[model samples]
Target: MDHNIILFRLYIIIALCFLIPLSLLVSIQLYSLFKSYALTYFLLNFFLNNNKVNCNNKDYDTLFILLLKQQRFFLCISSVEYLLSLRYSELDPLYMLLAYCYQNHNFCYVAEYYYLKALSCSPNNEIILSKLTQVSSKLSKHPKLYTNDGLIL
Candidate 1:
């Protein structure tokens, strides 16, 4: 076999093994994920109502939810893609936003999870600590029941 033919075979193998998986991962059905987020904010009106960020208030959380609910899958996907590209996984603000959404929806367990994630990113945060305490106290004896949404405690 010629050198070029060997290289071509290697390229094909690489493409099949790597590129295909990469594309599969990147081309996920984002709308479905957004819908199945188990939180509300997948509506156009959510973002349309608030664009301000008030950490002390629920505005930031609501704003993010609204942004996601706006049905702008490409925009949402790109924004998250940029964040991932920058390796920004443990951002407390992101966690806090999600936590608030869960809390607001009465998914206390999920909210607690995100609150802890936020605390890990930014320790000594009074808001998060306070939330953690509040949510912790509200945790039921059942370890898996979060809400009446059929989720296991």
Candidate 2:
């Protein structure tokens, strides 16, 4: 009876040893997760309120090179919203700056893509219409720009 009691007590101690450490590890991981979530929330809010994150000229130049020279599609596409927020009005004769930026970035397909997008907002625009015609003409020849429907020309 005494031996059985001793064995039971040993079993309880061994189970506790494993459980205590495992519980502690789990608690630590949860705490770390909560901290990570909180930090991400704070950073997101900071960037949202700040609009533009201050970067050194060299950093700006590096990003420009990456977007324009390296043809980083994501970077060029992401800037469209910010570019559209500029002072150019829908009635203005100026070229769509976002489209121009895509052009300067050598993202001609995206530039032509945005020309149609801007036209949806300003369909009667002669400048936009002319630019669209020119871009479409260019696209007809650049087989890479054609759709699955087949070549335009």
Candidate 3:
């Protein structure tokens, strides 16, 4: 009886040693997931509410910075698309923002299109010109002007 009791106690201790760390890891994971979801919810609500009114550059900048910090490029793209649908007069920045999101996703063609739109709106914007150049280079392809014999047309 004494030996059985000791063995039971040892088993209990071993089980607790494993269980405790497992529970702690699970709790930490859950907490982080909850925190991320809560932040995403809050930011989405903030963005939707702000869109109801006429937002200035500062507001969009804040939202853009937050979304970028969170690495929520799709959300940024969608939000910018929604704003673009509203036909805001100062569209250069919106176009630039959309181009940036597309660029991050490696959609160089779409990024180039938006960058061109932005450049058309603000012809003197060096930043837009630079971004357009970068995307253009990425999308560029060498022409096949020479024949199989290396003869020029």
**Span of ten consecutive residues with least summed lDDT in model 1:** 48-57
The candidate with the higher TM-score, 1 or 3, is 3
Q: What lDDT, from 0 to 1, does candidate 1 have?
A: 0.63
User: Which one wins on TM-score?
Assistant: 3
TM-score of 1: 0.39
Clashing pairs in 3: none
Task: List where candidate 1 sits over 4 angstroms from the true fold.
Answer: 1-86, 140-153
lDDT of 2 by residue, 1-153 (tens): 999999999999999999999999999999976775565445435434655645343433344344554455455444435434543234222236567676765677887877777788778887887777777666674323477997653
Q: Which residue ranges in model 3 land beyond 4 Å of their true spot? A: 1-40, 141-153
lDDT of 3 by residue, 1-153 (tens): 999999999999999999999999999999976776677677668767765646567767777777787798988889888888877778999999999999999999899899989999999998997788778768783233577889442
Sort by lDDT, top down from the best: 3, 1, 2
For model 2, the stretches where C-alpha displacement exceeds 4 angstroms are 55-153
TM-scores of the candidates are: 0.39, 0.36, 0.62
Per-residue lDDT for 1-153 in model 1, tens only?
699999999999988999888878776866556654534444223433534321232543354555556554445434433443555544787667666666766888988998898898889898998787778878853344467678742
